[model samples]
Target: MYKDFGPTKAVTDMTLELKRGVVTGLVGENGSGKSTISSMISGVYPPTKGTMTYKGQPYSPKSVLDARKQGIQYLTQEQGTIDGMTVAENMFLGEEESLGKKGIVNIKKINARSAEILKENGLENVIPTKMVDDYSFEERKMIETARALSHQPEILIIDETTTALSQKGRDRIYEIIAEQKAKGTAVLIISHDLDEVKHLCDEVVVMRDGIYINTLTGGDIEPHNIRQNMIGREIDGSYYRADYECSYDEEVVLEVRNLSVSGIFEDISFELHKGEILGIGGLSECGMHELLKTVYGALKPSSGSVILKKNGVQLKNTTVSVKNKIAYIPKDRDKESLFQATSIKDNIVTAALDKLKKGFIITPSSERKMADKEAANIEVKMRDIEQQVRDLSGGNKQKVVIAKWMANDSRLFIMDCPTRGIDVGVKEKIYKLMNRLKNEGIAILMVSEEMMELIGMADRIITMKDGKLSKEFERSAGLTESTIISAIV
Candidate 1:
């Protein structure tokens, strides 16, 4: 466990051994120090105290490159790739010098080499000639896997990197892990998806906030137990929002008509009441994302219009969507959300700049006050408002992002995958906040991959398949995981 963020420390007086040909999962919350453990093992950072012995030999890596030389490869939580460069260029980034022959950078040789590497790694579909920017985050990660495989490492370290992947991409990574296990190479994986940890790992190591809690092997470990250990408490009900009834029975606050986006969805329509929590469920590619984007005006609906009535006035574009008291929180808090380089104050204030200014002159005092207030409301764990957002973990960063838009006093909100990578502790707070907003008569439109969330939080769950509404379930009675799964698939 990390004692401090900067002078990070691995767990003290702790020892655990991973067997060869076995997969071991490290599970914890966002700042529970699991990633710190992985980083120390992978040589991203060495422990302040305590020595790591592998194969009965004292081992310490001065840098990531040093760790790679010792046959240990790390795939970071973030997908590391150059945007403008070709896939081949990124694959051989630092190792290009080794691939070079007689001080010559052979473009042809490298391209062919990248192609061969991808083919060997079961990713021949990703062309070496294609620009890295052209590939999705999952595709790029696969390319990175191929690159790591080319290094012929012994033990592979998969940091919490799989959440960015699609199902197919995740399957490919699983296959890679299996291949390495067959070779008797030890596997260490870190993940927030508890199901993934259970299925992939032979043994599970659970960590609480900055502490090594417990370790359990196959048959001995249970999912509920693991979750409890991670949170350090017993939880009631679902991870999603608590049950509540709609308070308003008046006219629809938002209406969509024939909303269609090319390559996304077809003519679809829906209405949201002024105070209701609506859940949209679909398979990974069932246009749920497009639906949320359309409502938030993030994507221009090809032929349809989202007519939002606020105090009997209609508004269109996202600029007006906000003006009409609508707010949307995206799923990818790291990517399409938080401003990492700026302070917490900046990220929170940037969203509502107009509120902090007197005509054209901005007030720093007002901005700081607003930022502090929002942070406090969201319970954002940070040292101070001046603290850079980059230092915070996934859960805290997401809280800051939520604070930004919620500060706008929106009447209607659309949240897309808001709880993707966070842990249950932060998740509970988010659920409580949603309930508070719902009680305040704010309409909520949410799309979540987790069925348990839909089953618990939504007043009504709408299932979509192939761009059409497949089914709808009311919260009045008889809603379960099995029921939602049946409707979704």
Candidate 2:
């Protein structure tokens, strides 16, 4: 895929197969040819020296429609739906000619059909008429899934699409896949979420540096074995942090009282101390994401205030929050975080430009040095810092986001599902980085969908249900995932 851009290969002589009525998983590190393989299968690009066949015939799709006709749907990692359109508008975008008369869009019919489609697909929370922008990052992601599913394709190719979905949305699509399997339709899922793969996929295929490593089935199937095959080495035990220092003064770094965001959440209040990792977990519709965004000042609160303190001092507004040592790492990297097609160095160093700036000018040499150091520390596997982040792997892209925040030296970090779509190796580094930051007296407020990650990494865990803070746990006292999960609902 990168042969024209540079004298490098994205995938070299790679061959993959998916049997009928089976779910096949394609796993690899960032820039390890997972996306490249997905592109070739989805007709985004053609292979240089190989053929991709379906069933018993040689098949090649020149465009997205060609791939779609062959019973293939691609939920690309990048934004695949139009941003300005409503959820229903994007859902039936291409096939709207049937509903419209003389190419004139019929809003009434479009919305009705969209609602029907989503309802049929088991997505009831997604409003048919809501503007795509107003929906949260994860909500919009489910809308994308609904769009891909509008065609009812036989062979479903979902690439990193489930990271943003709530458990309900995820279950809806998985049920559809199960139905398709009964009808003898083959499914291909490309995801970094190992738990999903283990549950959904019957067989697994591992790829590395554009080469086919091995395919594990039955007895050969395990997360560790798959990881070792993909990275060609044994990995660490825990993805969460290890080197943490629990010794810190009992100084409160943040305090919020009787905070409420109208219909989203009510009576939201919490206190955060310096050198503490606070985690929030709940079901998909529990409003945990809305609460976190409000804390970061990304979303306005109707009657709540976020107070940031260093040795007990309240900071001012949103700008002051970021300027006075607070950073918000969004839940959706493609939408709110990294810029695809931009260089990795640019993504990493964009947040730290204030440090590299003199008046209005940026120092390139110093910026490069800082970016390189951060990337190295995070173990970002990239050929060059100048390489575009779009072509990098999911795990590597996440590391770049982490590197960006670390470069800025933010004291209080508000992260929502930061490790949603990354591999185990990168997840471990993130845990280590969080511990390092907490040890340095940096306060972290994290919201995650993964219950185990919250239990393993968090110093204190908070549970939200119906947009209200219902329960809290102290990890210092040794909390269990079962206890945490039980409290969530």
Candidate 3:
């Protein structure tokens, strides 16, 4: 199959088969045509060349519904559930007629079915009648998973979905995939985590630069070999920091005192030192995300304050946070971080408005210069800075989010799941960038669900449980995930 996105070739000469009752994994770097192939197979776009055969018959779907009718279901990388709609509405979005009689829809029937599907998928906590906006992001992702599984598809394609989920959510997805495989359904997964591929895939396919590389089975599906095939180079066993010391300056750059948000998190207090990478980790419902938001001034705390040492005033809002040189990279990248409808240049310039202003005027040439310099520094792949941010892949979009803050010369960063939904190569770049920030006396407060990420990047790890602090671990060569897991669970 061949697919072209305007002037760029997304997929070229790619040919593969999804065998019945087998789970196949697709591993590739961002923009390596992994999503493109899945999109083509799931009928989001038609291939420019080559044919697809399903059940030994010519299969060409003109739309997603056509593919769905043919028993193909795809769970997208981005948020699939729509806001302002009930869970039942999103689950039966295109098939509402099936729940209706004589042009009138049966609301109770739709809710009942949606509830049953959620229960079957171990998401009984979610209320089907509630609007999708009422649920947290992780819950919404699980709802999307349940919607895909409710179809009883002949072929299932999940694209980078697990990275956005918590460990519990990911385990549920693994169980669902196993169930589909047992039911003789062909399954395809596109993921950047090699460990997940090794866990779930029966056979793994590698792609690079829109071309098929090789397939691995059994022992050949290990990380080192997969990394080599994906990037055409050898990566060291330890891609994280070389040092194993808990080192940071004595100065407290930011301080949170008795922070509380009703029903979310309560009485959270911590000090982030200059040149420190303070990691917060816990289950998805632990309120660590809300803690980060409160500290960044995105959410007002019920009773307590976030203070910067440079200016002794408390941060009351996002404007004050930015003015105090604080940058926040949200977990929901597409929705919270980037301006999806705008160009990369514009997004970058938005962060550095004050810096680029000249006597109450900001010029386009200055914007272009700052945007170009930061985008290139981060190695964002694009035709140019003028390209829309939505056009870039997950990894590049994250780079832009970081680049904008870099353009602003922010002294403190509050990142929630900084490397979520990103490829390993890009993750390495971000890790390196974090280290650079630390060396320059900048502080980072990172919140992540991935235990390994906190273990690898943070100088000190703080664990949260049930809306409160559970434990704190200092960085050491002996620090392990088991130690942290005990605190989280």
Candidate 4:
């Protein structure tokens, strides 16, 4: 398969095969054409070159709905549910004829059938009549999964779905995949989580720079080997920081006092010291995600305050936060961090607009220079800085997000799942960057669900459970995954 978007070739001469009764894992760095190939297969886009065959027959789909009618389903990384639509309406969106009679829709039968499907998939709490926007991100993703499975697709493509899900949600998806395999369905899964790929896939194909690099099977399906193949180089043994000593300053730079966000989190109080990486670990609904938003002033807290002290001056709310050198990299990078339709240069210079201003007016040359400097510093791979951010890969988009904050010279960084969908090569770069920032006396507050990451990179770890701080662990040689897992559960 070959796919091109204007001047950029997303995929070139990529060929692969999926077998029924087995899961085929597609592993690649961001912008590696993994999602592009999947999109072509699911009829989201027609290939610019080459042809596709299904069950030994020529296949060309005009649209995603057309592909679905032929038993092909694709669950994308982005939220696929329509905001105002109900669960039943989204599930049988285009295939409503099955639930209606003679040009008339039967809402009652649709709801009844949708409820049965949701119940079968262990989503008992989700009502078929309720609007999808009323549910959480995880719940909405489950609904998408349920909808895809409802068609009993012969070929199912899942693209980076597990990164947005918690362990419980992932387990449910794993069960569904297993059930599908038992039913002789061909599964094509794309994920940056190497461990997940190894666990769920029978064969793994690595792609880089829009081409296939290697295919791993049997004993070759190891995380280290997969990383090596994906990046076409050997990765360092130590992916995170190795320093065990406490180098943080004694003075607290930011303080959250009795922070409460209605029913999300209650009485959440914590202190971040200068030059420290404070890691927050918890389940999906444990309020850590909301806490990041409240601290950044994106969401208003019901009680308490988030205060940043610098040079004896107090800072609160987003305006002051930005002015005082505070930066936030949200969990939903696509929706919250980067403007999809804008250029990379525009996104990078967005936060640092004040720096690019000459007197009362903004200078385009100065903005371009600043954006170019930061983009080069982060090594963002792009044809040009003027390229649209939406056209770049997930990893490159994230680099642009980080470069924007770096350009602003942020002192205190609030990062939520900073490395969520990035590959190992990019992850190493981020960890090194964090270490460099720490050495410069910049404080970082990291919120992530990865236990190994917290244990490896955090100077101090705080675990939350059910909207409250469950336990705290200082970085030491003795810190283990089980020690943190106990608190998270």
Report lDDT per candidate.
Answer: 0.80, 0.79, 0.91, 0.90
Count of residue pairs whose backbone atoms collide, per candidate = 1, 2, 0, 0
- The number of the candidate with the highest lDDT is 3
lDDT of 2: 0.79
Model 2 Cα lDDT, one tens digit per residue, 1-489:
222236567787677887889989999876778878887888877777777788789888998777876788888655677878888778777677768899897889999988987887667877889888887666676777777777777687878777777777678768877877887778888888776788888899998877888888886767778888878998867666553434444888888767788888899889888888888999878878878777776777888677765544444355666677687877877667888979989998887788888899998888889989999988888878998998777778888888888888888888888787777667777787887888888888899989878877787788998888889887753567788778876
Clashes in model 2: which pairs? Answer: 30-393, 31-393
Give candidate 1's whole-model lDDT.
Answer: 0.80
**Candidate 4 lDDT over residue span 32-116, tens digit each:** 9999999999998899999999999999999999999999999988788898899899988987888899978899999999999
Q: What local lDDT score does residue 250 receive in model 1, on the 0 to 100 scale? A: 74
The predicted structure with the larger TM-score, 1 or 2, is 1
Clashing pairs in 4: none
- Model 3 poorest ten-residue lDDT run: 163-172
For all predicted structures, in order, the TM-scores are 0.91, 0.90, 0.97, 0.96
Q: What ranking emerges by lDDT with the best candidate at the front? A: 3, 4, 1, 2
lDDT of 2 at 331: 80
- Stronger candidate by TM-score (1 vs 4): 4
Q: List the RMSD of every prediction in angstroms.
A: 2.6, 2.8, 1.5, 1.6
> Which runs of model 2 end up more than 4 angstroms from their true locations?
1-5, 96-116, 123-130, 241-248, 311-316, 476-478
lDDT by residue for model 3 (84-149), tens: 899999999988878899878899999999999989888888898888999877788888888888
Model 1 clash tally? 1
